[model samples]
Target: MSKVEITTQNNTKKITLSGHFTAMDHDQFRAILDDLQSGEGCTACAVDLEHLEFIDSGGLGMLLLLRDACIKQKLALSLTNAKGDVLRILDIAKFDQLFKVVG
Candidate 1:
């Protein structure tokens, strides 16, 4: 199961995710991405995966999709507080260089 919570402050959006990020959660993830894309004048967006327990390849793909969208829109997209396997996956994917990875 996955849970995504979006909060906005100071023109920035924070997406906090927990549990597993898998095919089962794609709908929720896509909905959130659509919302972010539709939001007006957002300066930055942060995806917090501190509480995320597991993520599959599809989840990684979703992250890349969001990153590309944000880049095209000139919005800052950041991944924060990733650790353990999640961090390793991002590193292996070389997404560390493509997206901002914050502790």
Candidate 2:
């Protein structure tokens, strides 16, 4: 299971992902995308994975989808605060080449 929260400030949207992220979270994550698409004035998005404990390939795919959406919207996308297993997974996937990652 996973927990997701979204908040926006100063024209940036912050997406917080915690616990486990797998294919099962697809629907939940889609809803998040819908919310983002319907809103306006967001110039950037930061995905916060500080509390995320695990992420599977599906989770990585989801991030890619989000990145695509951000690009279409001309919004900057960044992955932030990833650590432990989550950070390791991102590294293995070479996501740093895809998004700006901040420690």
Candidate 3:
């Protein structure tokens, strides 16, 4: 199972992802992003992956989806606090080349 926690501060919407990020949780994450897309009025978004435990190719696809969502909504996106396996996966995918990733 996976957990998604969202918070808004000033112009930023932060999404903290926890647990395994697999195909099973795709819809839940999509719904959460949809909610953020619904006139939430944010100018930036951060995905906090510090607590995330695992990810697969489906998870990578979702991250791409998030990137597109942010671009379409004219929001800056950050993938932050990623460590261990999460960080490794992102690095292996070279996602840093595509988005802003921060510790």
Candidate 4:
């Protein structure tokens, strides 16, 4: 199961994603993206992956989608709190340079 909690403050949106980000979590991921995109005015967005347990290629694709969407919308998007295996994946995929990884 996947659990994605979102917290919004001012123009910044924080998405705390946990659990396996795979085919099963596609809907949840999509919903989160939809909600963020639907906001009236958002200047920044951050996805916190510190609690993420497992991620497959699908998860990576989801991240890419969000990144692209944010870029097109001129929103400052960042990923934070990645550790261990998750950090490795982002490094291998060269996503660390493509997106801002903080904390």
The number of the candidate with the highest lDDT is: 2
Q: Candidate 2 or 3, higher lDDT? A: 2
Q: How well is each residue in 24-62 modelled by candidate 3, as lDDT tens digits?
A: 889998987797787367899999998999988898899
Model 1, which residues run further than 4 Å from truth? none
lDDT of 4 by residue, 6-100 (tens): 98888888898887777677788788888877866889998999998877788889898889888877889999998888888888989978899
**Which sequence of candidate numbers ranks them by lDDT, best first?**
2, 3, 1, 4
> Could you give the C-alpha RMSD of every candidate to the true structure, in order shown?
1.2, 0.7, 1.0, 1.2
Runs of candidate 3 exceeding 4 Å displacement: none
Ranking by TM-score: 2, 3, 1, 4
Give the winner by TM-score: 2 or 4. 2
Candidate 4, superposed: residue stretches over 4 Å from native: none
User: Which candidate achieves the best TM-score against the true structure?
Assistant: 2
As for model 1, its CA RMSD to the true structure in angstroms is 1.2
Q: Worst lDDT window (10 residues) for model 1?
A: 33-42
The TM-score values for the models, in the order shown, are: 0.92, 0.97, 0.95, 0.91
Whole-structure CA lDDT of model 3: 0.90
- Per-model CA lDDT versus the true structure: 0.87, 0.93, 0.90, 0.85
Scanning candidate 4 in windows of ten residues, the lowest lDDT window is 19-28
- Candidate 2 C-alpha error for residue 54, in Å: 0.4
